[model samples]
Every structure is written in C-alpha cells, then in structure tokens.
Target: MADKPGNQTPNTPDVSESDLREMKVDELREEAREAGVGAVSGMKKEELVKALSEARSGSGGDGSGEGSGSEDDLGAGPDGGKIRRGPESSKSLKYSQEVTSPDEEPEREGRSLVTTHHEVIKEWAEERGGVPATVGGTEHDDHLGVLRFDFGGDDSNLRHVSWDEWFKTFDERQLNFIYQESRTDGNQSTFFRLENPGREDA
Candidate 1:
C-alpha cells in the first residue's frame, strides 16, 4: 500500500518501474541480486533503476542500489534501553570534624553510635542524680521519669524527676521537648510516665 525503501535491479525479466518503488529498501536489494544486478551496492538510485530497466528489457548489465546500512544497525539491544544501578549513599552515620575519645566526658565523640548515649544517660542519672525526677501525680506508673531535653544552645540535659512533681510544678499547657522546633501546648504536653507504685492491676 505504501512505497517502502528498496533498490532497483537492471538485469532480469521485464518488471514495471512502479513495482520497484513500492518495494522496501531491503526487499529491493534482494531483488537486484536475484535479477543478476552485480555490484548492486555501488550503484546510485537512478543507475539502479536504469540497470533494472535494461536487464528486465533483455539488455544484460549489472547495477543495483542497495543501501549501506539501516536504522536498526546501531545499538538495538538491552544496553540501548537499560538504566544501570549504582551504590546508594547512606543518610545515617553523620560524622563531625571534632574528635573525642571515650574518656572525654561532656565532650565530643566525632563518629559515635547513639545507642551508647542513651545507655550512658540511664547509668549516669542513676549513679549521680540519684535518679531524682520532679514529675506530677500518679502518671509515672510507679517509676520516676527521666525526661531528656535539648534546650537549644543550653546543652542537652536529662532531668530525672517524679511525674507528679513535674506535672504540678510546670503547667502541662506550655511545656515542650527542648529539641522540638515547634511549641507544645502546656496543657497537652507531658512525656513523663507516672507509675502507680502501689497498684498491681492494669
């Protein structure tokens, strides 16, 4: 129905020129060879047509116009469409320029895991601060609460106080974790777990 790409031959039985135009490029090359159009690859389009005409008309000669290459000749495999994968950089494990050894208390540890700090907080408060927490009411579930906060630029401090004591002393409506960028409603904020020491049932 459509004129595709192809070459014309000049050494075969009589064939119409319109038929040659309708053949595909690959198909025309094949026709030239079958019709004895020698050195078909060197001929120009016009020459190929002329040769094919002469050959088909019983005048023998060799000239066929076969294309040099095709669109599919270059890169038609998985590499053409594939996206390669590479190693991903990790987001955690941030490191500091300053370095400090384990013996440097209240100092910097350049690249340290955080779990060590939580454990240290629990231990130090129990040993030095007597685990004293000033919390409010029976909210601590019988356990004194130790709230860790980092008041921006004031240094992070773990305050071990009773839940009831804290609740009573500070208004829950205006309290917030020191490190949080946003303000917490004092009435709605309290991180302490006030435990009932005398109760056994849930």
Candidate 2:
C-alpha cells in the first residue's frame, strides 16, 4: 500500500561542511544552536562550521563536538569574537583604520574608520543628530530587517528604534560600521556605511 504524502517521511539531506562554509558565521552559529551544540556564542566561523558538521554527522554526542571548550578555540581577543575592535591597519580593509573607542582619533581628516564597538557607533551617530532606525516594512516578524540612522530627516520610511534593538541587530548581523570623522575639508560629515565581511551581498 502506498503511503499518503502527509504520512511519508521526508528525506532531509545532511548539512555538509562545504554547504556550511558557504553560510555566514551567524547562520552557522544558529545551525549549531539548533543542533544542540553548546558554547556557541564564543565560537569562531571555522569552529562553528566544524561543530555543526560534527553534529549533523551524528558523531558529535551531546553536540559539544571537540575543541569547543578552550578560550583559544573560542577566539583570541578581548571581544571573544562577539565584537571586533582594532586599528585594522591591515591592507585588507584598504583605506580604513580601525577605531576601538569613541575617544580614538582618525588617522587624519577624511580617513575612514571602522569598528564593531557599540560606543563608537553610538557616539558617531548621536554627534550628527542621528537616531537608531530601521527601514519600515523591512521587518521579518519581530526581527529588524535593515538598519539605518535617521538624522531627523523627513523620510517616512524610517522607523525609530531603541538603541538596544539596533545594537542587538547589529551584533547579530556581525556588522562593521565605517565612517569618517570629518571630510577632507575638515567639516563634520555624516558619511557612514555598514558592511558585513561574512556575506558578499552585505
């Protein structure tokens, strides 16, 4: 006797390492959490991919996997992978300097500074009369869709949001804020952009 479609067991494919590698770190972390992997918050992208792969393979008992307990395995930094703070003088982020604190000065006028620090972001926005906001109609259920700073603009598309909500989404999305302290002419500029290193689309 043939089984009904509703009663039939679906063949769900196992998540592969290659597939996991294609996903962003945040997405992988969510997968790990759903797979019962512990201590996920501290894991790096590579660590998350490894753990999720193990869990899906059924070889990872309790889904803790291996190498997930040590601080080194978690990440080597003061931010513990949650926040990235540094000068980022590296050539990879060409023309951009890392700013870890609100008090840090830009390398020079018009020099772009990048950071994941909440304080720096907040200070930069507030200094320009900008407030935390999200694009209206861009929400996914209770989750915020797109983040923006509204400088008392007349645009009705922006919806005001609490700093807490903005930061929560920012961290969750693993975003970096890039902005300039001043223009080349040394004037206060509102130039800013958001970037996600994990996703090409971002």
Give the TM-score (vs. native) of candidate 2. 0.56
State each model's CA lDDT, in order: 0.34, 0.68
Over 4 Å off, model 2: 1-92
Residue-level lDDT for 125 in candidate 1: 30
Among all candidates shown, the one with the greatest TM-score: 2
Error of 2 at 118 (Å): 0.6
Task: Give the winner by lDDT.
Answer: 2
RMSD of each: 34.6, 19.4
Clash counts for all predictions = 40, 1
Candidate 1 lDDT over residue span 1-202, tens digit each:
3352232333335567776665544355446656676544334455556666666676754422234232112121222211112232112212211111111232232222211222222222322223434323434674434333222233334454542343333222212111111123322121222112222221
lDDT of 2 by residue, 1-202 (tens): 1443332222222655666686766566566767777656556678777877777677663546455444223221234223343343234356588776544688788898777767567656866778899999999999997999999979999999977788788877777777887999999899987777666555
